[model samples]
Target: MAGEITETGELYSPYVGLVYMFNLIVGTGALTMPKAFATAGWLVSLVLLVFLGFMSFVTTTFVMEAMAAANAQLRWKRMETHKEEDDDDDDSSTASDSDILTPDSYERAEKQPILSVQRRTSPNLFEITDRVEMGQMASMFFNKVGVNLFYFCIIIYLYGDLAIYASAVPFSLMQVTCSTTDNDSCGVETDAKYNDTDLCWGPLRRVDAYHIYLAIFTLLLGPFTFFDVQKTKYLQILTSLMRWIAFAIMIVLALVRIGKGHGEGHPPLADPSGLRNLLGVCVYSFMCQHSLPSLVTPVSSKRYLTRLVFLDYVLILAFYGLLSFTAIFCFRGDSLMDMYTLNFARCDVVGLAAVRLFLGLFPVFTISTNFPIIAVTLRNNWKTLFHREGGTYPWVVDRVVFPTITLVPPVLVAFCTHDLESLVGITGAYAGTGIQFVIPAFLVYHCRKDTQVTFGYGTVNKHRSPFHHTFWVGFVLLWAFSCFFFVTANIVLSETKL
Candidate 1:
């Protein structure tokens, strides 16, 4: 199986792949968590985030197991077909020899060479050597409806990610540019209490300034979706560096403030109403299942894939706990901002002018690098979803329509509301729920069933989950539906009260 499928495109080491997975999972979702934590109360937020992280880890392993099974199935089928073709050629040559063959028939038989699978032993049924993307595996193992559902779920999740990126970058620009500190940092932010409705320069209100910034942002980045972009290794490194420095500063600053006996927030133990949004934010923060193939495939050694993933999740959980816990305790509940960095823009929060500038503009720099890449990703997904086996689209449909569809709806949503917490929460709870929870569960169940039927129950995949019991699949489904019901009921109840 290893020979048949060329899986040796090991471009990076296993540890590098682990870092890639960690970066992918810990993006914009982390930026929106502090506000949600303040709303839900610190104790409730901690419990919910820990549980959701565990749930997400479980589904992640399910995806890894399914990937292995898909590869094994591919290997077995290729070998079977090769054997049948060999048998056909040998039988045909024998039949011609038995009969009175013409010169033409003999020449044809001489030209034909027999390829025999008998020369090779049966493929290793447990070997996982190739990259099988989730969509391809879905089509391979799922019913028609399930395949369509998988695509739909993934598309919605990608749209949600794009929307978050779109809104966050512009909102950060608006905050940092308009609200400067009164030190070596900058001028006064007008009235310190003036809301997002305040004017920026002349007649342009902050909302209007946000719209202008959004327009400029769209013009700069949106066109990239129409064409293809290449590797962004340098961009990734810069953004990652900025991300770590900014987050570390915020956490350290908050802890120092608490030690000085100036902590203003004293949240209750738990708040049931806020739990709905907290669960969504945590699930969103832990999502990397959709991109698992690209992250896992290029590793030189995959034997320790599980260990690497487990360690990454543990670090991410600890980071989220520290960051949010510090934010909620350092600032008043009402003072927490949707974009966490805004909480530090004021000199009072962090007296250093340089630190305030860095923290305030962090989202603009980091999310800016990501926005174009995600736009292109969403555009490519559109092409794949509509692609036919032997057919092609016109240049206009291929370039314009797909990119437009990818770039517009999200920008429009962001324009309507730069409220990052609500945007992240809603998107996470619904589309994130499907991708992070329900889809992976269904994928593993179907992959396992297909493996049993094709390779018999005696065959065990090398990468099957540690919690490989059938019961885990059912539990994932049940928990996802329960969250869905609770979120829906909460939204309805809030609307009724309004």
Candidate 2:
């Protein structure tokens, strides 16, 4: 029983776990969704958003089940090792077969139900206690090629995340700081459209300002890659507060505008052409599956875990609907900015200068808080990918090379294009598909098989997904493939048209 348990981290109530999950899923993607919603039309966006949210929920359950199974496997291995040590110490002629059942023996025992496992305490073999990251799960459930592919997909996704953050922070600053007018306050109602070439500060153009801010951003936050980022409780609370205030302000402002009949938006009922990007945005918006193990495993009690997660998804879906629907109604689809907050900065939409400034700089505040953590994550993942067992890296290579590789590519990508919409879309569509859909499907499928072989079919995983049937796993995989093909075809056709 002692060998069967492993410490994860500071445990919390399921409600706190739900809040953490909600925060993780609703990040930069939510900010980009309003524009995508406007482009795709309300009806299509609504239908697809609901469907994608459900699918995300399904896969989330898959990850939870897999986590439980992984814990069972780890616990069983540790128990076996402990039993082996005991056997060596005693060298008993009558070793208890029930205590150390191997896979083959477990199969035989399944046929012979008369046998019973004796223990001081009969603990649930499949209870989820340890936090197994998606990377660890990948290694456990996937073949060598699949493991490498998982890392590759995750690395690419993180790179996209960093690039989006990089471009977004500077882009937000550029929008707020650059002006066609001579006034320092920069008339929010100015009719003149400024581009990269437009002068911001005398000799400095808007593009130059963006680059300057990007460099400043790198200098300010990029060094955390060389160190570690341990986000404390206060930091989490502060960021969560900023996020809620920003979201509440945006939603309220949009509603107020529409309520007053000052709304300029009239989105189409259906736009098949925009569905491509909408799918990506929705997928990206509901992405919490990759980090589920870290979030879910720390829950002190999981008696109502399924219910809690379902409730979280329901709240999230409603929140997303409110945010996007109001945006599409209050702002013209053609005029919707990539980052939805930028739309609020317009004096026409939001009259208050303070609110406009806060909204404009909101991405800067939130994204800066996340940049270091993500950069360090990417750096560690790089080190992990190339890492060999029993081998040690030199200080320069371990400290300098990994961080440099992690920090540079994303910044370079940001320099090339600051298209937040496309970055989120491509990242979510391709890599997010792998993480959110394909990986969970396979992980659950493989873990279930392994659990049956190792723990016998009679052992019940208390944390098993509601969608425990094999059919559900197959369905998820099929949905993933269909989305991938459809998105690829759409991208190709769109490119050809261009």
Best by lDDT: 2
In model 1, how large is the Cα lDDT of residue 49? 89
| 1-498 per-residue lDDT for model 1 (tens digits) | 121224545367778887888788888889889879989988888888889988999999999999888887777667556655665766554554432333343234335421221122234555556778888888988888888788888888888888888888888888777744346335434122557787676777888878889999889988888888865778888888888888888898899999999888887778888877787888889988888987787776778888888999999999999999898899888777788888787666677778877887888888887777778877887888888889999999998899999999998988888878877888889989999999889989988877665554545677888879989999999999988998899999999999
Off by over 4 Å in 2: 1-6, 93-123, 181-194
Alpha carbon deviation, residue 461, candidate 2 (Å): 2.2
Per-residue C-alpha lDDT of model 2 across residues 13-79, encoded as one tens digit per residue:
8888888899988889999998899888899899999999999999999999999888877886787
lDDT to native, each model: 0.79, 0.84
